[model samples]
Target: MQLSENLSPPEGETIDPTSRLLAASERLMAEAARRFPIAGDPHSRAYWMEAMINQAPDYFFFKDRDSRFLLANRAVISDLYKETDLTGRTDFDLFPPELAQQFFEIEQEIMRSGEPMLDMEEKIPDGRGGLKCLLTSKLPMRNEQGEIVGIIGVARDITERKRQEQLHLGQAELLKMIAVGAPLKDVFTALIHLIEGQIADVTGSVLLLDPEENCLRHVAAPNLDPNCFTRIDGIPIGPAVGSCGTAMWRGEPVFVADIETDPLWEGYRDLAVPYGFRSCWSAPIHSYQGQVLGSLGLYGRTPGLPSTTCQKLLGMATHIAGIAIERKQAEDRIQFVAHHDVLTGLPNRSMLDERISSAIEAADDANGTIAVAFIDLDNFKLVNDSLGHHAGDELLKTVSRRMLDKLRPEDSLVRLGGDEFVVLLTGPRRRGEQLSVRLESIRKAIADPVLLEGHSVQVTCSMGVALYPGHGRNATELLANADLAMYRSKEIGRDALQFFTAEMASSAHEKLRYQEELRRAIAREEFVLHYQPQMDLKTGHIFAVEALIRWNHPERGLLMPGDFISFAEDTGLIGQIGDWTLRAACRQNKAWRDAGLPPVVVSVNVSARQFQEPEWVERVASALRKSGLEARYLELELTESVIMADVQQAVALMHRLEALGVHLAIDDFGTGYSSLSALKRFPVDRLKIDRSFVQDLPDDPDDAAIARAIISLAHTLQLKVIAEGVETREQLEFLRGAGCDEIQGYYLSKPVRAEGIETLLRIPNI
Candidate 1:
């Protein structure tokens, strides 16, 4: 009530009115001034105090000694929406025990000492969300007897200022780390820790964008539920992807609160729900020139947008991250170019040399040997000149892949520029022959034909080997010796391999002369065919003849196949010679039939190299058509050793021959290893037992047993078996009793010229 209205004299005093009013107002105003001192009327102290408390920016509350609230200002009532009552409510009633205990202790101290606790920096709740940086002060509320009754604590909101300062400090430290060339992951780790410390109820992460995979890879994400990170490690970047991927895809920041309902978290809501994170925000890390490198993601358990401080921190971190990632990628590119071959991705000469040096030291320490092979592609220039350089490049790439596939994981094949490469074999010692076998496998792999530009281009490499301590004491010496050996291979003929030896250099001239003579022999057409007759044991009649090749050197008189066949194979001339032999044999057999000789099957030997040709079957068909001879009259004999190497291809080829009605025979059967199961797949008409089994057969039980088993096995398969080198009547009788179908050796006739075979064929049972 207004004092002026309440102070009227009862029933209107009859005395002087002005004097009476002056005395009454002076007395009431003096008592009001004692309680409230303001610029306005002194009697309205309660209104002034109430206005001040409600208008104050900071929270003002008074609590009793037991921390029970006695009075709260307007800010306290509005901020702590549910804590309105002042009669019975205490700090424990509003806050958790741990938080209320802190308040209780401060209030107790203030009341006991009758002093004020001022400007205490504390992390307290702002009554709305998360923790706040608060500068709280508590003062004792005392009565007139000097007994403390209650306490008042005022807390000013300083959350933004405190967090902003912390963010700035963290940014400086992180930048310093990046400037000092910290590893990308390490810098990311530091940034994660900085964010987790400054931002309340949040986790930090740095996800790198993989350009190749077009996804975000989790680089670092500490202080988070592992599922939120580990489960989404490589998320594809797209519109519907999670925060990190979406941010990178859009090249901007993405903020998602209430993840369950956000469209951006359509498929990923379950991932955050289980981990207790309800919100996610991501900002793309861009290169200085604006390329999206990766992203920085922040996740929080509370559903809300990022605070102002967090937003500022993410911006700076992404900028710094871009610079670091770019620097790292550039360094990696330089390192890769220096160490690897651009064409094959194999080690280059520099890396190979380094490895060789390290290998040498290790080998010397263990007193072991290391084989270093230098490989050079033969006739590579011809391929480049005839089929464009592009085709040549394709051929090289195919060969590189093949040779690489054949190497052991520990072995390294290094490109030494152009058509040359070096291979290093280290670790446990291997025999010289084993190393030779490995190198041979690589050469054979390279020899497979590669189809490029409609032409099947086949390549063969010449590999020269030099062993550590035996051929050279160092890498340079070893390489030089290997080069010398490679040159020796070229001097002998291309597509040949040799080991380093001092004597090879002196023999090189002699090898060159021999190569020249051999080349001339092929050009001069000085080769002849000899035929050996095989008589049927059941009828004692000659029905087949094996054609043998012999070289008639102009000055050397006559030369056996042993004298020139190896050289021919080494020079890659065996394919041509094999084709020639087939044509000659066909024509000769046809002529013999035209001459009224007894018809017989003409068998020709096919070498390993010739049989592997892509057109081998076509060549056979062409020969039959050209000579006008039936395929049934001709039999192609292949050694067991060659056919067994690649059983599948051999089976297919033999089946093709069967389709052509050409009889196929397995020659030297007892001398090779053939699995019974695989041998059954071959569509062969006969198995010619190698002569070695028959030469001393009847007397030697091992040979007799071998020959008997072969004949019995052939009969079981419904195949005819022939025993060669049956020079004696005893051997012939033994083979016949063993169920052999035929015999071919001196007992019948030696390998003679076609005319000589025709004479024997017309002699009936002779």
Candidate 2:
């Protein structure tokens, strides 16, 4: 029978035939008839209807002809957790504006047609994520006179059932990862993500118990702050520890309703508050034998016990975590050997790559930088040769321990192979000076003595540093650059740290190519010498000339010493090049004398490498003998650094040159650390004051004083003091007044080719 046909009708008014009482218990139907007053007597009907629906769990409401809420139940008024009465209010007050308009139109249709609406599925916010399904039924309600007055509606919640279906489907997909033997970390990551998706306002994490360290280490926490994860990791399990730690320590599930005020959560309240986590529940993960392996925790933004759905899914995650944890523990020993160094117990290259990639991503997201340091022990091969392999192994272990002690707990040290390691400094790396300070500490730690086989062996390491996003965007480029820099440190001298730069990376290859080209230049004669005449004071005459080498590149024009000399010195090519220069300059001087030109001594500069050779004196004698130029017509000049380095050696070399009747002079004299006592013993005849002291001339008092001191010292020693780089009359007059024996600078003439020197030799002197 229809809803109005079974109910009584009033005498003066007919029932609204389209209106009907909805299906309910027999008692409810009778109560509705009395409350609706089918008999047209309605003193207590309104009160009964409001009181009844208020106790109903489902949403119930009645609206007037204008779509205003004439009455509402506890469920309707309590939406979004608001407790105010909704009487005489419109749907605009209870729902969003657009939703209210649509609801009004639907209710108006039912009221005008006087028809009952069966079950209609609608979705709305369950006051959480705004996505809950409900079954709504709308119908017209008549008054005691049987006249249609307004519309009444009832809604039943189906959110929990729908969420349950999604949860089960998601869990099924997550199980496949574990079935295929995915990595423990990957599986845990998937499991936590699935639980978070089904549960509203909650994030999940998985932690594994490291029995050796007696702490809980984070396995997966996709939503947690990375820095927070790092801080929370390695938390020890004990009484009143964090939720996860305490749960594992007690061997049971633990729930913290409010992190801010809960005594059990007091330890981590500060850490959780900043991340917007106010509630937490953790379940202990257990193996099949009932031994606790780890914990599965769920954290929510608001403080309270978790929902039924969150609690249920947390238990499911705990089971999955247990399976993976047990499997990983069983395979830990084999896996550790595969990923870590066998001798030093440090992470191997494969694990280093994994960790570096993760660190790089985190750093990029944080807008920070990380330094990858490649370290190699110096003379490590020597240890293996002199002491047995066992002794070398012991030394490696000792060095590894020392280096590890010098790093932060978050930093990773990986042994890439024998005598080589990489350190991932997972801290702020914006400043190079800060990294340099840290690297210095590590270097000093590695330099400490290591006792091996009853012998104390002092070891040192060379390290190269590369930064992320500056040196490289990824691990491979970073590692390659760092390795190149380390080799550069070894090239210059070992036992120091070098930060990687783009220039350092190309220097080695460029220098090698340059050395080869220099060798070819020696064979093919691409080098040409320019002569700068040294004037004799008190006489308009050119007494000597300094031969400067220049390179004529086939593509680029003339190249100066600043372009390739340092590379030549570093590669030991300067020795051969300097020898060639000496012989060439001697022959040119002899050619001038033979050509009926005034005889003049030509000085050739000596490099540190050429000066250290045992046959240096013999090489000089051969150059003069081959050219048939008398020794007095040739001068050999050494920079102050080369001469002052070994004072005794300098005196002997100078004495030998003097005994051969060849002139000797110190080039760039004032720039070096030369002692006055030592200078007196040297058999030098001339001191070429450095251009740095003469460029400013009399204007710069410091330079003037230095020039004066050198001139005075040279005169006291009975040696000639030649001031170079003089470019003005004031400078020339100043030097002449100070008793400078000679002047060689632009004030006379710029350095020129031998042809130009012909004119300069005939020109007026300063």
lDDT of each: 0.82, 0.80
lDDT of 2 by residue, 1-766 (tens): 3544455666786655344333223446566666555443233455556666767889887788888777778886676336487677886865688977888888888988989887888876555547768889999999999889998888888878777787777677665554444688888888887887787688888888888998988888988888888988888888788788899999998999888888887767776889899899999999978988889988889888877866777788888778666544533433454467657889887577779999998998889889899999999999999998889989999989988998888899999888999988986644455778888899899999988998999989999999888998899778888998898789889998889887876755865777788778778878889999888887958898889999886667788978878868867788888988999898888888887787788988999998888788898999888999999988888886788778788788778878888988888875554544466677778999888678878877756766776676567568898888989999998998888989898877777898887776656553
Top candidate on TM-score is 1
What's model 2's lDDT at 1?
32
All candidates: TM-score: 0.46, 0.37
Per-residue C-alpha lDDT of model 1 across residues 463-564, encoded as one tens digit per residue: 888999898888977887888888878888878889999875565577578777877777788899999998999998999998899989989988999998
Clashes of each: 0, 2
Residue 264 lDDT in candidate 2: 80
RMSD of each: 32.6, 30.7
Cα distance off (Å), candidate 1, residue 575: 58
TM-score of 2: 0.37
Clashing pairs in 2: 3-21, 125-130
